[model samples]
Target: MPKFAETIFQIMKKFFLSTTVLAIIACLLWATPFTAIKIGLKYTTPLQFAGLRFFLSGLIILPFIKDFRVKVKEASKRWRFVLWVALLQTTFLYGLFYTGISYVPGALGAMLIGAQPLFAAIMAHIMLRNDKMSWQKVFAILLGLSGVCIISLGRADFVFTTTIPIGVGILLLNNIVGSTGNVIVSRDAKNMPPRVLASFSMIIGGAMLLLFSIPIEHPNWTAVHPGEYYISLGWLAMVSALAITIWFGLLGREGVKVSNLNTWKFIIPIFGACLSWLVLPNENPDTISLIGMFVIACSLLLVNFLNRRAQKAQVRLSSMASH
Candidate 1:
């Protein structure tokens, strides 16, 4: 095959993978845990679930991908950024996520985290030299916030006020911190393979968190159940790590924002709400609650509008310079 044909084939492959993988990963990862967290509430405290998620995730995942291990002596020179990214990205981010999951429904937790795309666009707009923002972004942000409010509070005249505020605060922080991590990963890190990056994140983040967990953890060797741990552990690593790693790599190749070009993450709230309601029927998200979720869904769609405008600005500038 000619070089041009090979290049086109590679590009197409990456595009197909990125578009499908990220969304696919998003669905299962979000749904399973939303259910698991509900179950975990029956068995253990939120922090236990949080601690176990990372510790077990690391132990189960590390043996498979040995390539991510950095040499101790040289890491200071070359892989220094990994430490920073891991701490912020995995350490604090997942810690907050699992803790937040304990207090809220899984679907709600995922949508809150998924909202980072909006935050990401702002970071990308400011940090990337070529990606400029327009009025569409401002309107989108405002509309998106409106949607978020509706999801959080709306009910059949029964607002979800006063109860889950802490959960919201935790998820909100996770979104911001995770967005900051994304910007750092995009801007500072070397262009490494995605699997390697994921492995590094899991290892470093898992280890650091373990250190904190060790002192507090009481060995319930008899009481602790392995069945649910295995289930959540397997799904999170395979779906959230391997799949998401592939998705991020595709984003780098196919434009980090291209997923937004389609009706991408706006569906997060839909899947989240439906799955949350279905999977955890005990929580019982009513019609008003569903409508509130619809508002969040619409806001996420509006966030994509910002994505489109940024792309248009790039096109117009390119056309002008061509003259």
Candidate 2:
């Protein structure tokens, strides 16, 4: 093969592979959780279900890692950050997530979680000096917020009554907590092995949830059906193990910003909505909700494109200076 043609073929091949990997990871992280969480809720209280799932998720990966004890001691020295991550990411985030999903449709619940990237961008802009929010990002943030609002109002006659507001509030809180956790993880958790960090933080957070759940939720251990219990455990564990490790790895990767990677997460709702429609037919979103999804998608694309272009321009300027 000619050298130029060979180069073109290699570039195409790399693009295809990378695209395929990203799609698979995105689906796993976003799509499967909606259906899985809905199914899991049928057999257990929200807190107990979330607690056990995450604890086991961490435990599942603990065995594969070597010298984690030494790492644990290192982590202990930075216990404040580690515990803070546990509290924000696992404890507060999943506690609200499990509870909110119980009160809303799977698709709506997932869409609310989809707004997390907006929160992540805003948080990164505030916290990370290098990731300051540009005018384009600020506009994108507003657009994304509007999309979420559209979805929320579309569900009812704009009446904030009963469980609707509570569910929405909880899901929104989940986004804030989860986004804060992302920023912290990017800042602090990058030093540890990604798997070790994922495992320990999950266990810490899950333990807190379980301790609170026993007294508050008062879950009857025997009441859960064996099949439902196992299935929920299995699905949640897989998500925790796979999605989270990949997430931490991505965050720690060189040149990856919390905002840049998170912008891609806006598509979660689209994937989640489709999956919910297929698996939980009753949770199908209406016309207005679909329109909201489209708006969010556009906002995400705009933010990501602008950010990438800015990064490339900065690189070119850096190259010119070196010359």
Name the top lDDT candidate: 2
Residue 11 lDDT, candidate 1, scale 0-100: 95
Tens-digit lDDT track of model 2 for 1-323: 99999999999888854533554485457557656776777787789888888899889888877887887788778888778878997999989887776666644664587677778988898888877777888788678767766665665553334677788888988888898888888887768887878888899998999998999999877763758658767977977787787787777766678877776665665565666667764677689879988888788778768867987999999999999
- What is the C-alpha lDDT profile of model 1 across 154-194, one tens digit per residue? 42233354536898898888877776676666555546555
In model 1, which residue pairs have backbone atoms overlapping below 3 Å? 34-106, 147-295, 151-292
Return the TM-score for each candidate structure: 0.70, 0.82
* Model 1 whole-model lDDT (C-alpha atoms): 0.59
TM-score of 2: 0.82
lDDT of 2: 0.77
